[model samples]
Target: MSILAALTPAPTTNETEWSVGDLAAALRRTLEDAFGHVRLRGEISGYRGQHGSGHAYFSLKDGTARIDAVVWKGTFNRLRQKPKEGLEVVATGRITTFAGKSSYQIVIESLEPAGIGAWMALLEERKRVLAAEGLFAPEAKRPIPYLPGVVGIVTSPTGAVIRDILHRLEDRFPRHVLVWPVRVQGEGAAEEVAAAIRGFNALTPGGPIPRPDLLIVARGGGSIEDLWAFNEEVVVRAAFAGTIPLISAVGHETDTTLIDHVSDRRAPTPTGAAEMAVPVRTDLMAQVDDLARRQGGAILRKLERERTDLRALLRAMPDADAFLAAKRQRLDLAEARLRPALAGNAGAYRARFGQVIERLSRHPPALALARARARLAAIDHRPRTAMVHGLARRADAVAALGRLLGSLGYRAVLARGYALVRDEDGLPLRGVAGLAPGQRLRVEFADGTATVRTEDGGPLAGTEPAPRTPRRAPRRAAKPADPAGAGTGEAAGEAAAGDPARGRRAAKAEGAPEDTPAARQGSLF
Candidate 1:
């Protein structure tokens, strides 16, 4: 057989031939069937997206070969990591034929970085873009509330993450928690989480679903691929824009995501997030109890101090009846003394008036007698009226003096809150200069007397004496000789003869002259 004839198989007589369109359709089916699902690792190239349609067209190329890739608008929009030129990525989708172009290409359903290095590069790029806009600034972070009345949680409802949070909250401090169910991982996890955050923020404050004061976005520990949802820009931006404070508890302590930086607070686990939401009820109650006890003690102490001061004040007040009786006795004595003086002064004035009248009668001329008669008529009741007015004035003066005396009395001064301080000699101390520390004294109040001692050179209302100092010796004076001038001449002669010391002694003893140095000098001179 010929080589050409052997390569070609004999056609069946009843077989049908495919048209151009039919052959293309059949080829597409064959491609889909052969590679319904595939993963290609290569550097992306020739990447472009239709702005209007939102579809992405790209090429994957390596050292050996290259292939065309297409991502539908919906799938492109849903992708966690977008395809970029020069990025080494893994494209996952089924192979299909484009009938119009007669070409086979990958219809990408999902795309990701090919390895840890590629993934980290993509992550860092995304972080840079967001951080440039101030989304990750420390100043942009909000403070988490110490106690939230309603805490909204964005996590999978069925996972241990939610249960752990709830159990931890109940253990520390029970709070009202509202759970917004979301997928924690996989294809649309990021969208669900971001939407949940927005929904919580959009709620009216007093709506049927009470608005949360705080939010917690959490998921259990997982690999980086599993935790990639939290690293999505959608989730991070949503957390950053949220008005309510958010706590991110995405994975184990070692695992970090973009959302952790944007969130108000970061917790290593869901249970830790719960613990940070509110304080312990028992601890708060204990603090309140301690404050109440301290307040009560302070009030009691103040009342006791006031009571003691009041008792001391009462003891210092004088006896009212005895003080008034003494004043009455003094007033009666003053009245008796005033009456005799007024009578004697009036008698002397009356006799002087009579003598003036007799003198006027002796010098009566014709015109003088007429004027005298008029004067006598005018003076008829003048003496009696004068006597009565004088007596009234004296009485008023006595009453005024009595009032003045009462005001000046020691009892009155004591009643007005003054005390009399007497020294050891029983003499009233009138000035502070007379006081000395360690000296005993009597303090007389209106009602009673107290024995006190000086402290710091001032008398205090206490019994303890201040520390004592050495007493000074008393000065002696020279005695005078008999007033017979016995030693006067001798002392003067001795002083004049230059024996000044002996002369001074003799002069001082005889009292002949002052023993001052100036007098001695004068006698010598």
Candidate 2:
């Protein structure tokens, strides 16, 4: 006989003198005691959780039979995972007979999920639906700007992800990091995360925080069910519609979620997201200073060019010839009138003219002609000499300019000391920051051209090393704005010198230190 069959009541006395309630109660107690700690294997047919209590009511069933089951608050709290309808489970509990109701129930001690192929399929289907919407399209993603003003992070406040993000941001950007803390997984987690995203977007009046420029949606890596909140429609929609650009950094590099598809960008990890959001302040500032210097130099050069042209034109002008031409024309007209007035006194005038001619002969007009010729020659020589001097000065200036350019590292290729390597598109390989070794590249120099390969080492060692020559540093590269003061050595030094007290204050106020290289460079810029 089965153990259950053995537990059945012995043959009852014919019509025993006992009330139904009392006898039923006794039977219920006996059955409860007997079946305590028994284990059952079945699929769930119905499941319901109490709203105000941690109790679950469900039915455990095989294809042919079903049994009522109840998980008490204490047991429910101890469950490692949630239970759903139609889930296969191995349940441990005792059988309890409800006396008055004439029903049997299983009081569950522990329960665990089993054979969730259908749930996995459901998850896959949901993923496909979202993927079809271009949520997972690579081209739809954006790159988070380096060094954002504020970062909005959404994740469970108590989880390790939040701590990781906070710690990374402190070590990296150390800027204003606003958190929209929410549950990361399970039942209403999706809704909570979505609501947090929406709140950050709204950034209402009198709110404790400002709207962030970038949003980080993150969580530690976990199972599919544990990461279900990120896969929910609410969370995905929030990420897509929120005004702030979002970085979906929900799990490890291999882990992807619906939130990743809808977000502006996807980072492999929470730390990566933090890194992407901010640039090194020092680099930014250097760029700004470089731009400023270039602009100032260009303006100076333009002014000098205008001044030189004006001076050349002034020197080439024929001031003396123009002045003497007008005087000569007037003298000619006077001599023509004097010829007509001399008609009547011709003989006397002739005698007088003869005497005057004798006097003019002594000091002939050739003398004045010679003087005018000398003055013209002097004027001609002055302008020509000025032009020659100006040419010489300009040549010297051009030479100086060339030297300056060379000192700025522009002439290394010309001297065969170094050669520029470019791609097919002619973009120079200035640094190997991104290129792979063994890639084909075009090498160009003043004398000739050669194709080269990028060796798997630091810089290449060629036929002979060039002698070291000290060169003046090039004018700093410029940018629209000093990348908020990042990338400059001077700015970093100043920040180091002055930020001690301020850093302490900032750390206390914002969980980060002050005088970040980027921030310092920004100040300089």
Candidate 3:
């Protein structure tokens, strides 16, 4: 008996039994009394997010036990930490039974991690995941430029971190700065910070807005819970994928985050990032001035040394007339040899030019042009001849395929001599599977078809078979053979080619199977 029936009172002349709903209600109240308020700690399981009704449903499970759990819309909204699979949480709520499902559930009013240690375990697991992906690798870091033209800062506009970075930059070599205002903490803060990083990278270099040469993601010091947005996977991944170099100064010198590991450089403070971005302006100017003075002094000393060397060489120089006498003698000697050399070169060049003219005459341009024309005329007719031959070959292939299709046709088999069996519905029957005693069947022979009835037990079994005579009681006929004008070869083929309805009617009248087209197809199958 069902539990309801067991709980219900038996009917009497003046008594009544409990309804199903009333019995279920009683059980629900009994459950509440036994477990009205309780606290459970277990790892969450099967959490696929919230239902449309804003209710969250999942199960709390331990090594060998599992119980259904739910957080109502109001309770879920007020929860400090949302439920997630594999997270061990402490649930404070009341136990209740739902009649609709005939199951028990814990209606959670509050949910949180089991303890501070659980939060650390979760954070460590997330860190390992990010590190395994190579996002925190040393090779992933890019060098920060010594002097950036523009700096893009990602932080809250109203925060002290931004103010510190700006003030520090002004004291050093001041440069262009672009600020991307974003929430440093709270809901969706991680996503906004990531978008800011990507936005800085996406700027067209020479467009209306200049892309940042360096990026700084800074935030004032905060507790671990407040700094969680910087440690989020999205923030870490954005910093890793960004083309611009970045310095992460999320918290104080002692605080660390995932973004710090992935960023190009990690600064101890916001001011420290600014100092790393540029050099001191006054120091740089003084260094440049000193190098300029050294360069000028070296040039003056080289000019004075050259002037002194020229004066010493003048003291050892020869007389002007003596110097010119040898040059005049050399000029007179060169003029005498010049005319003979020019005449000899003229004769050699004339002979070479004559040889070239003779070669040109041997192979004239006109003869070459005539041979090319002849070859061109020979090639022009080949295409038309080839096309005619190709068409003839294709036509032959088509005719051969047509012959192949005809030889393989089923009609060719029917014209040879087989028969087929069909049911009353004109559907082919391979066996006696659905047949019963007194069932009508169609027997199609090569020439025509006939109607017959199953007898005895069925078509395939009986002590004696039905006689080959009409089912009609008023008349009897002889056993059938091939009818007149119908037999094995051409006669049967002609009979089958005639009206099919006429053959079916004749078969019905004689009550015998006839040869038809399909039957003559000698069992090709």
Candidate 4:
């Protein structure tokens, strides 16, 4: 019923019936030997991890038949398309048995998408993931070197791709190309291509082998499967991360890869990449020659124009000697006329100056000023003398007026033994008729005042009684004063009768000398 049993000699009669463990062990060996390193194409299902054991457990199913598969972590990690449920893929591994469970399973060493559709789906998913990371943005793209001294290329060394690039570079501008041989397709191709790109980048500048200024990851045109290595995330990221400018020439112009989008530039073919790296030698030479000729022609034209301008300037300029001679002649003629004209002007000026001097001498301001000075000096003392005399006279008159005022003052009358009497209201009593017997009174002397009580007998002992004079009757109409001295006597008698103080003043004035005509005139003034 089994390969092990069929291969044995009927298990030999002496052989005891195999134990369950032994049978399982024998069966595992038989299964492994018969189906070792088999390839299976199926849709993945029930995929699970090896649970930290660095392995994966899954079931590969095609309709009814299904097989359990296990891929070790090492193999699983290396797989370009990792195992996922519902994905159709081709799994290549050895068939092995799990004795504990008594089950047969394929130990997958490698895995790939089963068809173009699966591959495309995986490719699109990868593209989206990397695109979200901004890896494929136009701004991320670097500019390819216009001319590289050394060009690094990553592709299959045996393929026509490498030859084509080399030949293209030779046809254009020959360059030192470093070829990093790598598998462009098949298993492990992605890793090789990615590693090659990184290896080229890791090279030290100015080393034994000069670091490439530009890089080219190229492969001949092929189907998507044949070209899928270039689309790998590892390859695309390597190209994107490389410092050197990279040009990706993968497959035909119509066939696109992830590297094409990530690389600095994309070429339709490997030859195109070579062309992008360097320009044609002959074309560059021709350009340099053309530029040199153009520059020379420009210089010659400029020099010729400058020469013609110099000649025109020379023609326009007058002869220096003739110009100087004409100026000299004008100077001589001006000088010849200037002598006599200056003499005539000087003589005329002298005559006019003499006339001005004569007129000035006739009405000399200095002489007039001297006369005015003498007159001012003569009058200056007169006004000063007059001011002094007038001041002295004014002072004398002020002193006389002060003495007169003092004699007329009330204090002067009090000093002459006269006392002023006032009632309680501070008013001088003109008569004793208004006084009451007990009313208070104040008597003012020249020095001070005393308070006293009014009585029928007048004030107290310290006070003096007021003179009792009968009240005067109303005066009859009196004759106007006569102009002569005769009427003065009658007027004086009448005044004395009315007011004794006025009569005393008039008698004192009359006792003085009569004024003469000159004295009267002086007093009038």
Best by TM-score: 4
Q: lDDT scores for all predictions?
A: 0.80, 0.69, 0.78, 0.80
Off by over 4 Å in 1: 1-31, 51-54, 97-104, 307-525
- The TM-score values for the models, in the order shown, are 0.57, 0.45, 0.46, 0.57
Q: How much is the lDDT of residue 360 in candidate 4?
A: 89
Off by over 4 Å in 3: 1-116, 304-525
What's the residue-level lDDT of 427 in candidate 1? 74
**Total clashing residue pairs per candidate?**
2, 22, 14, 1
- Candidate 4 per-residue lDDT over residues 59-123, each given as its tens digit: 99998899898887778777877888899999898998898787888888888898899999998
lDDT of 1 by residue, 322-406 (tens): 7699899999999999999999999999999999989878875777879989999989998999999999877765664454355
Residue-level lDDT tens digits of model 2 in 121-177: 556777788788876677766666666777888887886788877787776547888
Weakest lDDT window of 10 consecutive positions for candidate 1: 516-525
Model 1, TM vs. native? 0.57
Worst 10 residues of 2 by lDDT: 516-525
- Candidate 3 weakest ten by summed lDDT: 470-479
Report the error of model 4 at residue 414, Å.
Answer: 44
